[model samples]
Target: MGIEIEQKILGHARDAHPHECCGLLLGRGGRIEQIRPAANVHREPATHFEIDPQALLDAHRAARDGGPQVLGYYHSHPTTLPEPSATDRARAAGDGSIWAIVGEGRVTWWRDEKDGFAPLPYALRDG
Candidate 1:
């Protein structure tokens, strides 16, 4: 529910533009520490995303040193809806982390809270 965190997330997602921007959320208990951008690569069009290994490792280390790390992850959906697609569902990683869907212009975010990836009510959140 803060401007600074929201702006960071939006800025990262926006920076990706047409391509999906992948990253990790670091923080603890509603306190987002950082939004570290990772590899946001797709096999092609209408496909799922794959984070680069090197980028992932770096992110993990960043989270370790930064703060409560591995809060969640983010990626843009480009021309698709905010909802998860079949590919997304299939590729879903049940790490109990949040997932952000950045549409062409709009943005939708979800979080894994025990049950599943539920839509998160937009609010001032960290990580």
Candidate 2:
């Protein structure tokens, strides 16, 4: 379940970096969510990812069409690790948000926990 989400995000992140890539989260039940690219705002996509507010809202609305909410947001740390950077920590995608940090051309996801972002490292599990 987790691994699939990471893979989906990784694909978008790698392709979207060094600009921030965003998308709607799709899935059934509460597992197997997929990341689908929306649109990015940052024109200088080399070291920063800028998401348009309208685009994000649109994505969220679209997800509702599929029975899911925003589920938080994701962006990439180009040429870096999947680990969250200081910026990522300071301006996290919100407390309950799911942060997907894609680097090394891969994806690693974290869930917002009271202790802060907890790694939900991509893994495959049988349904």
Candidate 3:
């Protein structure tokens, strides 16, 4: 992930404080090149998030047209740790996508594997 990208994630989290902010992580391979912020359409935004379906569709379409790939998803945990919550685990599709959770002044990455979410380590780089 780029340092700027990380900053944007943190900033988004801060801006949406008390309500979960969500977005798509766009890039190729292992680098996150951009973040496409989306509306959280969940009924209970304060503790949960649901990225707007239209946003997901548009991202996939863009990727097919040679735009940045949808590398993963990101969301903020308003009052919890950066780790995945029970609700997150229950909703995960086990699709092997990267997930970035932000909270308490930090961000943590995880891989949604078939079995479960595994902690992932990432290094920030300058663009």
Best by TM-score: 3
lDDT of 2 by residue, 41-104 (tens): 6666666666677877776677777755566567777777778777667766456666667778
Residues 35-63, candidate 3, lDDT per residue (tens digit)?
99999999999999999999999999999
- Which stretches of candidate 2 lie above 4 Å from their native place? 2-5, 63-66, 125-127
Please tell me which model should have the higher lDDT, number 1 or number 3.
Answer: 3
**What pairs collide in candidate 2?**
20-49
Candidate 2: residue 26 lDDT (0-100): 52
Better model by TM-score: candidate 1 vs candidate 2: 1
What are the clashing pairs of model 1? 1-124, 1-125, 27-68, 32-126, 32-127
Residue-wise C-alpha lDDT for candidate 1, range 1-127, written one tens digit per residue: 4556557667776777666667776667865556667776667623456777787777678667864667777776766787777776766776667777767566577875555567887666443
Report the backbone clash tally of model 3.
Answer: 0
Worst lDDT 10-window in candidate 1: 40-49
Alpha-carbon RMSD, candidate 3:
0.7
Worst 10 residues of 2 by lDDT: 23-32
Query: Positional deviation of 23 in candidate 1, in angstroms?
Result: 1.1
